[model samples]
Target: MMRLELNLLIEGLHDFEKAKRLGSLSNEYCRESATIYLSQEDSSILGVSDGDIVEVSSKHGSVKVRARVRSDVRRGLAFMPPSPYSMALLGLDEHPSIIKVTVSKSSGEPTSLTTLFTS
Candidate 1:
């Protein structure tokens, strides 16, 4: 796969229903929050499709997130919901809202958010 080097731009998006219906405890909820939105141009470059989980890594940290192929995002950039996964990536960078990340398809289910830092 031609993995893509992407700089993720955090938009601080919040989903009330995701929080209200499933609450924060559910892995599904965290997965939803951790989903990454990548532009079609970039997704094709990475050879990934929507819902395909990808590992996003930066200088500070890394996290796995489901890929959302979209044209709405700028090429060379992506968007992620504000969550522990995304925050972990942010912790590595001086800029709190954005981070440089490499995008690649994950072999299996993305790593769990709860155990991301621990195991």
Candidate 2:
């Protein structure tokens, strides 16, 4: 599948309040996390729509999660709230903030955060 290089931004969202209060293991916390924000143009190019499952792969690893279409993010850019899903691709290391990843529509369901942290 075709891939693109995007300026990745892992930032806090409004749900930070709820996640902080509920704790990371809480369902509410997991529900409010790991959403990948992509521009409408980029989403279409990948043959995906909002809420579609997509696999984002870096040289390190890959994570399958839900895609979110947003005007807030410009083309060639993506935003994902910090969570276990992104952590799988990030691992535990001092890596560059900007990553070249392949984002493509996934044939399977969006991976759960539990599985992400596990195997």
Instruction: Provide the TM-score for each candidate, comma-separated.
Output: 0.84, 0.82
Query: Quick one: best TM-score, which candidate?
Result: 1
Q: Look at candidate 1 and give me any clashing residue pairs.
A: none
What does candidate 1's lDDT look like per residue over 62-87, in tens digits? 77878888777889989887677787
Residue 106, model 2: Cα distance from true site in angstroms: 0.9
Model 1: runs farther than 4 Å from truth? 14-22, 117-119
lDDT, candidate 2, 3-113, per-residue tens = 666766676767655685789878777756756889988988888888888888877788887788988779999977767766666745536355667788886766786
